[model samples]
Target: MSLIASSLTFMKTPLTAKLNTQLKLFKIKVKQNTMHTLNSILRMRRDIMKLLIIHPHLSIIGGSERLTQILVYELEKKRKNIEILVLTGSRNKELFPETSKIKFKLFKEAPVKAKNLRIKKLINAFLTLSEVMDDFCPDAVLTMIQEPIYLVLSKIVKPSIGTAI
Candidate 1:
């Protein structure tokens, strides 16, 4: 099994300090158990032009969650037609006012000020994403922060273009 899968097994074992420690060791900080489809996401690089990057909050500010911003920038730079649609996990906007452009959009129910209710954010992201997909039809929608929820949603809505970073 891969590191991710093993991590999942460890997580499912139980909820305890040991499990929490294991989750941290493996960086298993996701909102859902949708990671079973990660392998498909790895197969996405075979095609690149039709890409859609997903993020829960899509914040372009200072936070440990800057990986989302990095994903957007990297994809945008590599593919000129990249469209970043944020499935916002935060209640507030993660905006870089000086750098605002048409590249990003949010699907958040409420603005999150802190990381208290992570599961709620993931649920919000999932609910909003279904509607967002119908409007913004892309060949492939991708993400890294939202983990399995984003990956599975992308696959269901359209082709998923995932990458390992």
Candidate 2:
């Protein structure tokens, strides 16, 4: 009985040691695998040189409006093809020359002078532009016109470039 007890105790010591070693190895392997996956994702994004920018609304106003315009310039400067699909465009469409490849689609266009009824405009605009977006399916959707539409679409869509989509 004493001999049996000694053997069982010895077996358990080695068994627990093996388990602990396996656990350490598994932890190291998991971290390496996670890092490898993250790097691959970043590399894939970098490989994509082409970009589609969808601005839900844009008009000659606000800091966001200015930022959106600047981002387009930066993307274009990087030689990434910029497809500016505006669901509701402003008078600034003329800002980019006709020669530019930037395609402009306007569900609603701004008048010379604008009033602040953007929320109402967005609700109405979404109806017409939804079809356009389905067809266009841009890489990112930038919301120059701050409403819930961009958020809704982006949730289902990936690479939704909030910077200037």
Candidate 3:
């Protein structure tokens, strides 16, 4: 018989009653330790809030771009402890002086004259966003515009990430 089976047999004897009680206590201690470790992990996750902002394109100065810039500025001002990262398909930071300090991960711009430009842009955005999500592991994602790709990617890559449009 296996050591565990032999131990079970031995534990059944009246003489080993104290050993069986100790084993039960030991199991309880292991369970408590496991619970404590899991709680610590959850508390650590709560301590650091990471926010990822997805903007497909920031090359031009537009209403949506301005709103994103303003949102980043306000978030930085108010949430000092929260980490923020902006993921964009293309960016011309010079166009927005207000967002000069914002952290941005810019994806390679698709060739203007290339065929299937829209498809290429979409693919690039999806891949880059996936990489960013893996590396940063943001707690939440915010998008200035209604982009289904962002929502879909967040669900695929990290379902735990809360997405806000």
* Maximum-TM-score candidate: 3
In model 3, the Cα lDDT at residue 31 comes to 100
Better of 1 and 2 by lDDT: 2
In the predicted model 2, the residue pairs found to clash are 54-165, 140-161, 142-165
Q: Write the per-residue lDDT of candidate 3 for residues 1-165, one digit (tens) a residue.
A: 468745875666775776667878998999999999999999876886788888878998799999988888787778656677888767876864434335788875534454786777766666777788889888888988887777787778787778889
**lDDT for each residue of candidate 1 in 42-113, tens digit (9 for 90 to 100):** 555334344455555534455534665666556566675444554454423444221222245566565646
Clashes of 1: 8
Query: What are the RMSD figures for all models against the true structure?
Result: 21.9, 12.7, 7.3
Worst 10 residues of 1 by lDDT: 93-102
Clashing pairs in 1: 56-88, 56-89, 90-112, 91-110, 91-111, 91-112, 92-111, 92-112
lDDT of 2 by residue, 99-153 (tens): 3545566664424243657665655455445555567655556565556655565
Global lDDT of model 2: 0.57
Estimated TM-score for each candidate? 0.43, 0.45, 0.61
Q: Number of clashes in every candidate structure?
A: 8, 3, 0
Where's the lowest-lDDT run of ten residues in candidate 2? 156-165
Model 1 TM-score? 0.43
Candidate order by decreasing TM-score: 3, 2, 1
Ranking by lDDT: 3, 2, 1
Candidate 2 vs candidate 3: the TM-score winner is 3
